[model samples]
Target: MSSDKPQNASESELPQAVPVRRRRWAPSLVWLIPVVAAVIGGWLAVHAVLSRGPTITISFQNAEGIEAGKTRIKYKDVEIGEVTSVKLSPNRQSILATAQLSKEAADYLAEDSRFWVVRPRISGGGVTGIGTMLSGAYIGMDVGKSAARKSEFTGLETPPIINADLPGHTFFLRADNLGSLNTGSPVYFRRVPVGQVVGYELDAKGGFVRVSVFISAPYDRFVTSNSRFWHASGVDVSLSADGLNVSTQSLAAIALGGIAFETPLADNAGIPLSDRNFILHDAREKALQNPDREMQPFRLRFHQSLRGLSVGAPVDFRGITIGEVTAIGVEYMPERKDFDMTVDIRTYPSRLDTLSRGSRISGKLSPQQLIGNGMRAQLRSGNLLTGQLYVALDFFRDAPPAKLIVRKGMPELPTIPGDLEELQRVLQRIVKKLDAIPFDNIGQQANDSLKSLQQTLDSVKALSDGLNKETVPQASKTLEQLQQTLEATRQTMKADSPLQQDVRSAAQEVKETARSFRALADYLDRHPEALVRGKEAQP
Candidate 1:
């Protein structure tokens, strides 16, 4: 009976079981696990893109329009990469453009590819990229794959070469209107583009312009030592008559101008060129290196007319420019006591070097050409209105062989004749002579002669009246005296008579006085300085 009661209690206990409920572990944790995993995976994907290629940081002096991710770089007009980030360098001297290059750009990236900001610039050489000057463009590159210089991708402050590279070349030149010569200006050879401008810097300290020119690789060897470069962009000098001009040919070209370089054909071995870089030139040294050298700078003192020419004028040799004007001033002549201006000339050194100056040289001559072999000096007109003069050179055979003459300060240059100066001097001398005539003395002499004639007529009429009328005693006496006087006057006409000789001598004195007076006046006019010690005044 006790066993049965225990079994029923056990069954009743089972009926007192528990209700079904959620455990302590959350069911939301299943969805939360997946959420955390997704966040981590998204972060990993971004990291992969960031680390896709080699990191390159390009530093520039300025970063006006550049922005990370916004700036893109193109290779052969194909978009290759975008900037990843922008940060100031340690010293704050430059802006570092960190870029994340794509696979293609990264593959072709060589040691020589260049990077530079596309910013507008203005210079004395020229103005450039004026159309899009307000909104700058993306960075540009000249991608090159080469064995040389291809170690790593390090962004350069200088721009890369856009055109082909030149092998062996060197050109010396000046940049006047170079404002347009930016990182993208095109370089032309015989009007055909073979190179491009890479970079530029203002060389204020050097007194010259610094320009980086890159010739395409194949043509690189063609550029030789006998070359010259000059800015071809627009330039305004405020000329007296010529108006404003504009030169726009390329995006990289200066808005005002571009550069023109020449490589003269020569068999001689020329200078070798490494990679392209900015060239700083000294104008004086370059002039000395030119092939056609000139005579050393010499001054020619000119007292006579040089064709009425003057300063800033061209000095020509066979119609080619050879020299320029330096100065012109007058100096006193001790003998003539007059002033004469001497013209100074500055000839090109190259032209001077070739001249056998002062050496006993001989050559053929022609009267018509007035030029033969020896050096001849002449005048050139620079500014017609200003009457500026410059010295010019010519060759004459028959003309006196010019001898190099050295003076105390600066040697004078050779000079030529001028029709204008000759005419002017002749007119001036004539005027001086005319001004010296003695009109006052001549007038007094004429008045005296007319009075004497009048008196003689009056005396003759009185004598006639006395003869026609009955003679009064006083009249008779006057007539007798008159007759005696007339007889005496007639006798005085003889060279020997005492009274006649006196009158004759007085007339001679008058003639001599007129001549002496004229001579004195002429002497005073020609030599006015002598007037200070002239003869004593006549009473």
Candidate 2:
């Protein structure tokens, strides 16, 4: 009994032999939760690793509205990437943004791809990105056509004036200066807006401004090889021989500045190739002028005053513009002992060729021969109100003989006095002749003569006074006596008066006696004649 108790106690304390049973093992609910979670987590990790796109770094001048994990990269308003991180570059001169793009955008990470930050902005192009004011700023991308892939890019400070996908043609213009032109300045074709200035920069030589302009489709076809471009920035007001001319593209152009291009009617409008360069003239007048080829420099020296005559004055031939005055100067002539106003002019002989039916002046007639034939340059008033003067060339039949001479490597054309100058000279000569007259001597002699005439007039006045005071009464009495005598004589002559009747009877008797006497005389004279003519008249 003691041994059994010890074994049982030992068995109970050590181990107990149990029968083996084969049963199915199942996982607990708690294990299921944890195992399912682990599977799902592994799946998500593999997906993230496999579907991830390329990471790119963009360097910007400023981070601006960019925020890591908040700012999105978008192409055509669709989100394509997100900014993963933002940090300063090693030089601290720019902000570096690391972006993670979707797998779909990986293939478009080209070398020339453009990126910019979109925000509310107003430029000459008008308001843009205005929705960003409420929706917040985002990265804008313009996919490039380059085949090479790139992981780094430089962000643009401003949105591009033109979109890469926009259908247009880009042209380059070289200008001496940028006159009030901005990036979004409008370009006009026949005063209609067809494009905008995309970009401008100084040329490599820094001699001119190179402007890049993009003309939209359809309108781009109008830009031909012979097209002329000029600034249409403000109102162009000019006065010419025709009249006052005022022109403007539009009110907007007058404010924001603009450019205008036109293909001349007479020119061949050949299509220009890609990346063609054009010259931007300062004014439309200059852009449309016929190109002067083979310019001949000539000088004209005038002895008259050169007032109102300025450089750039038109040099015309019989009302046709053939050249312009390039320079004006004064030179002292030792031989003439006077100063001569020198005008340097550039003339296009081709103008004459066109006018003379393709007969060139230099080929047909020498300048000397032309001058000998009385070709002369004379200053003429171009505008009476503006007092502007232009050089006029014409045949002067009465002009003094002259010759074409060369001095200082420039052909000198002889000049005749202008009409105004000749009139001034004539007046000056008349004034000299008037000055030569003895005016002082004439004044003295006239004074003496006036004194003698005054004395004679005084004597006549005294005689008239005497006649009125004394002699006039005596004369009146005598005239009255004479009138009385004439009245008596008139009464005696009337037949109605007795004395006059008796005189009339006496006169009648005297007349009868005289008639009798005349008859007797006549009879005696007849008898004498009869006696002299013999006895035939006796009866």
Candidate 3:
């Protein structure tokens, strides 16, 4: 009983001693974790919102030169934006490239801004953008000048040949054919490059091809209203009377072709205008030959064969080109009752101008007036080797009287005889002279002379035979007889003959008599006058 009481009292005393300081409800450290997390998350959200940039969607025919994460958009070769994603549009006909542009570049996006894939290209001008090969292709952007901003853009299929700010003038050139000239073909002035062909399009009327070209400053001032443009493609080899003429620009033009222009020496005095239309000629000669003038139509009747002549054959005046043949047709004239050729020719009055050129010709200088002044047309040989013919006009002061007639509103000019007709007339005269020759009588006389010559030859042959046979033998016998007579005479004169001995004795006697006569003369000389009796007495 004492132990139980002590245990109970001990329990009560211990519990009372703690005084049980009432446990107050307080917050735990676990609640602080959520609050700290909220503060950090709020700061991160604000930072992300502040750093975000404008998003732009670019449409392209195909997704080329673009990477979702790695591809960068460059302006002036500086990175200003990055491609974020590439997706197809709702129509699925094109690729939509969404890009994130830097805040500064956002203002640069405009309607006029151009974006194109920069790739390696080989053009008439030569290889360009070749760096794209090693670095891989990339998108090139040309910043627009417009103040208006736009986030979306459509990409270009090809890079522009001329930059809008290239500091030059853009002009149009119309041609019937594109030739070998392509974009980037050089535009040359006197073979020095000054510009390039940018682009081309077909006319809506299908009449011609229109090409766009750019001419840089300083050189642009050289192009005038009368400046002529022509295709300068490859080496122009012309075999002419002057000799073989070989002309070439750069080696690039030899392969890819090019365009060249020059202000004609005749038309260089005109003022130049900006952005004008110029005709594209097929060749340099064609461009040089072209005259800016009003064309007057005329007709010529050719009685001779129209060989070595074409529609575009030149019409010349004193070796100077004045027009060209436009058409050639053969029609029978019921009155003439023969096939007559109707040749249509267009004459340019500008060719006659020494200074200013006028289009409209007055009635005072009409075709009828010119024909009345002895102006005649004739065909002449242009090239001897080629046998090419061209129409020639000159004042034929000796030409017979003729008149100009109008038919179908076109002036019909009188044509004098061409060289071929003159040649034919000469041949006809020769034939007539040949016909007048007495060929049959000459043949008969020639036969008679041949017969007489044969008879004379036969007589000579008989004489030769008589000389060789009978005459030769008789002459030989006579010569032998004469030899015999000489031998007889020689024998008579021999040393052993009596006749020779008698002649020797007579010669000795004469010699002795001469000795005696000489001795007598010597004695007479000594005795003074021995011729008297004195010489005998002395003897």
Clashing pairs in model 3?
none
Candidate 2 lDDT over residue span 1-539, tens digit each: 88789888877887668899989998778788889999999999999999999999999999999999999999999999999999999999999999999999998898999999999998765789999998899999998879999999999999988888789889999999999999889999988899999999998999999998999998988888888999999899988899999999998898889999998864446565754799999899889977767788899999889999988889999888999999999999899899999999998888787778766666788788889999999999988899889999899988999998988789999999898888889999999999999999999999999999999999999999999999999999999999999999899888799898898899999999999999878876777765456545336
Rank candidates, TM-score, best first.
Answer: 2, 3, 1
Best by lDDT: 2
Residue-level lDDT tens digits of model 1 in 1-539: 99899999889878665788966965666699889899999999998876676566677777766888688776655677788888888998877788777755665566666676655656544564464365445776666547454423445544344433435333333443345456666676555667666666666776666666666666665566655555555432333356654433444343534565555457356465442333322222332244543344556666675555556566676665666666667778899887766666666645533465644222322222332245667665556797765555766455564555567676544444554666778999999998898989988999999999999999999988886675677788999999999997787678677877788799999999999999989978887877678655669
Distance from true position, residue 36, model 2, in Å?
A: 4.8
lDDT of each: 0.61, 0.91, 0.84
The ten-residue window of minimal lDDT in model 1 covers 360-369
Clashes of each: 58, 0, 0
TM-scores, each model vs. reference:
0.44, 0.68, 0.64
Mind giving the per-residue lDDT tens digits that candidate 3 earns over 1-539? 98799889888777344455788899999999999999999999998777777888889999877778877788878888888999999999999999887877876787798888777887555577788778877777888779888888999988877766677787788899898888888899998999999888999998999988899987887888878899998888988799999998888788877899987665555454544888898888889875655778899998888888898899998867878999989989899899987789988876676333554344338777788889999988888889898999999888888888887888889998898779989999999999999999999999999999999999999999989999999999999999999999999999999999999999999999999999878877788665565655434
Predicted structure 2: lDDT = 0.91
Model 2 residue 244 lDDT score: 100
Give the better candidate number (1 or 2) by lDDT: 2
